[model samples]
Target chain A: MSTSTTLEEPKTGTWDGGNEPLKASYGKLMMWFFLLSDAFTFAAFLIVYGLSRHSHLPYTGSPEEFQFSTEWWPIPEKVFNAFPGFHGVDLPLAFVALMTMILILSSVTMVLAVEAGHRMDKNDVQKWLLWTILFGGTFLGCQAWEWTHFIVGTEEGMLLADGTRIFGANMTMNQYGPPLFANLFFFITGFHGFHVTVGWILLVIAFISTVNGVYHKRGHYEMVEKIGLYWHFVDLVWVFVFTFFYLI
Target chain B: MAAHSDHSNEFQQTGEIPKAQTKVIWKTFFILVALTAVEFLFAFTMDAGTLRNAIFIILTVFKAFYIVAEFMHLKHETKALIWSIILPMALVMWLMVALISEGSYYFDSIRNYFN
Candidate 1:
């Protein structure tokens, strides 16, 4: 029966439906597939994070005793409260919130650029793309500042009653409750930041192509739309990271 | 009337312009901003517990879908394409739940035995 089924004639052309059953362009569909795989990678990282956090030694007891039990995780707000130019002020989550806003704004500009591309307005496309690049660059700069601030070590830092001082952050040690917490923070946010950098490069190329009238000659600006899909995917990933890493 | 006809021909030369979607894009932007504000509010006000975490996850998923729908134009795509992307994500969710729960269970048992 299996051999008989194998001998059946192949369905070609209309009989097989179109090559792209979803009707998506090759580039767009490939971008979706890439995003799907990347999503799984992030999901694994986060699941490991949850597992590790559930097993970490949590800070407890008073300053005199300073007990550690496998029952607590570092509170994100207490760790990420510092903001640029504010220095001593206790502004919990302010800096990261600003970073989130900047990223969201960049996503808006990316969509605007794609929309302008649809109009075949080269000037508008260039303008919006430039704005998107600027916003993305600002977000990158903010991340750099945040990373530096984290590595510099606060004045108080984390002091134990036994006079053990934990300062700065690394794979093996962090002032945060557990080293695993810092490990996950660097890996997840660093991965997301790398995506933002890739989006920046893609936008710059799309901008240059727009200015050179390449898309204009093509009679469509689907290139801008394709890159826009990537930029928005970066933003979508940030939404999950923000909630999981920073908030919850 | 002649100028209007010329404009229509110009549109024909180019693909259909999505000028109408500008309003929708801005609306999504504001909605996202509002959601971020709500998240920050919860982060500051709500206690760290299951309820707060659940709310954050729900809100984050809402933001993710809104961005995919409006910004990526996934919502306007064919049902097959949407399902192709969404259905696979369900497996990711399953993996997350399975791994986290199992890991936590093991940790709980190990901690109890050691204590």
Candidate 2:
């Protein structure tokens, strides 16, 4: 059967030309464009990161002279070592792995929600969408824990061979590889985390709408699909983060 | 909107529909896992050498392609839309090459001048 234009057309009269103009709903199309621009912005940040990394380090002293940690630039694995408490267990990347799984699972649930939307199953749509939101929340919680762990020195307190306390921020270029690296890490990932929080809020609103019969009355679940696109975009950003920040 | 039809039987037969239009999430997931395992293997086994770094970056690009194409559903989009997203991204490759080369040069200079 021919897809009915009447059913698919934007209700808000956003369509300007009759040539189908991408033919997608206004929200979905706009989200795509927004993500495209956001992708470029991130690319610019990463490229600049590469450039800054290329720039010369004014090594005023020998590596042996650098006292705090023998390793240069806080190895991501060492820096982000907050896992569920198990005495005597050294889970270096356990938290990050959990965070990755949470984000991936959320993306899966989001796809399921959208699929339910397409099939017009309101109850299943709501159920899966709520699961997606829960997963997002769990990821955010884990991130908060990570930030706290990073900001606060270990429970054993800051230990230096020379008997000097290494404050978190002062754990800089000399101690943590490069000051710019830490700065960018906080700025870029923090910004992305903020976006994830916003996306989670939006998903929650969409979920509430679903429960209140907003989409049911409106006769389409396209809003959920639109939000799902946003959610998936967030997941895509994290994949880049994992590669650059962790693996690379 | 047309009344929600009783396609329950048809939907039940088909099972819960996937959000992605393509039926390749499982395939993509497996590919991603394999690529990641390779990355970890290389990370652990390879010595600190330029070749190892180069291979790592190549493997990363491969995994990135699958994620963008299949996971993000860009492969299913119209050619115009895909190009609009990709052409600008191509510039990032040049950016990476230029920046990394410059960084290495500066790093060597700093090492020599300060020491």
Candidate 3:
């Protein structure tokens, strides 16, 4: 009798009243499938980047002309300078490092929130979710500052021997590394930055839900877990960006 | 499944967990930092060449593996799901190599013809 009951339960569950097999929660499963597709989009961008770097153009400008002290695509340190508060202090690539830390720390807090949700700890979930949102917001602020610094050029624009501007937004091939290089940089990183912005918005929604006692009433914090997946995915992408765009 | 629900409930009441067996996150971060330092050293010390480029690309892949496996939790997922993510990426990898080689060849041909 027990075996018959177990078999009957699955039969009722399986056929969704049609040919199609019923599956897990539609929303949660769809989010995973969507993220998988997004991953491919990012892969396409990075692969094209590989192709561009390999292709050579007529070498019009020397490293010396572009104020690059090194041979490779304008050493990231020279390209990204943190805002000046301490005069005469050389804080190159410092902003990028801070941004990395912020995103990573946010991911940590996000995981904690997800863990809290599993336990149905309402207050703990709220607190950690808020922290995650703040961390993401702060990272976006830092990125905005970095973009401003990039666009406006840096302190008097360090002069080349031939009187060309060292750092600024007007980064054409003659002025910077390769014109294509700068173009790709803005497009790829900017697109990723936009993702970070979207992630922040989603975090805010999760935060609001926690505050409103929605999860508490619903009797589960699965929403937090789902958002946490998205948050971690953003951080994961940044790791690749750091390695490929900044380091390599 | 019951154990999972209990674990979730325990998490709600307290804001902590017995750390998972994998210290994967910290390991991934340190590996990335170490790789970055190596890249910086290479950039300053080495001349531009095919060999240096090869090393840089290899190290980049190493860092990427750690990020995707540890940070993204792909390593913890089911084998079928893992293959779904990785197999498509293999195609992208092939495309990259093919496109870059052709691009380089085309550039060389253009230079030879013009010169």
By lDDT, who's the top model here? 1
Clashing pairs in 3: A118-B8, A119-B8, A119-B9, A119-B12, A121-B12
Rank the candidate models, highest lDDT first.
1, 2, 3
lDDT of 3: 0.68
Best by TM-score, which number?
1
Span of 10 residues, lowest total lDDT, candidate 3 chain B? B5-14
Candidate 3 ranges beyond 4 A from true positions: A1-25, A57-75, A81-92, A155-167, A170-174, B1-63
Estimate, for each residue in B1-115, the C-alpha lDDT of model 2 and write its tens digit: 5577654334332455444443566567667667766766775566434586677678767766776676566787777678877888787778778877888887788768857
Q: Tell me which of candidates 1 and 2 scores higher on lDDT.
A: 1
lDDT of 1 by residue, A1-248 (tens): 45555477667763386476778888889988998898888888888887786665444434334423213577777788898888778788899999999999999999988888877877789999999999999999999998888777577777766887767788877776677787888899899899999999999999998887788778889999999998999999888888888887
lDDT of 1 by residue, B1-115 (tens): 5555432334344454445358899999999999899988888777678899999999898899889999999999989889989999998888888877787787788778957
Please name the candidate that would achieve the greatest DockQ relative to the true structure.
1
Worst 10 residues of 1 chain A by lDDT: A62-71
TM-score of chain B of each: 0.80, 0.72, 0.75
What tens digits encode model 2's per-residue C-alpha lDDT throughout A1-248?
97756666545543555555455667777888898888877777776766665573533344234333433344454555557676335565567767877887787788778777777778888899999999999999988877665665455444567886564533353334456766777777787899899999999999999887778667689998888878888887887777667655
Residue B33 of model 2 has an lDDT of 66
Q: lDDT of candidate 1?
A: 0.83
lDDT (Cα, 0-100) at A210 in candidate 1? 83
Q: For model 1, what is the error of residue A108's alpha carbon versus the real structure, in angstroms, after optimal superposition?
A: 0.8
- lDDT per residue (tens digit) for residues B3-103 in model 3: 55433343343455444333555566677778766766776577545687678778868866765676555677666567866787677777777887887
**Fnat per model, in the order given?**
0.66, 0.35, 0.31
How accurate locally, in lDDT, is each candidate?
0.83, 0.70, 0.68
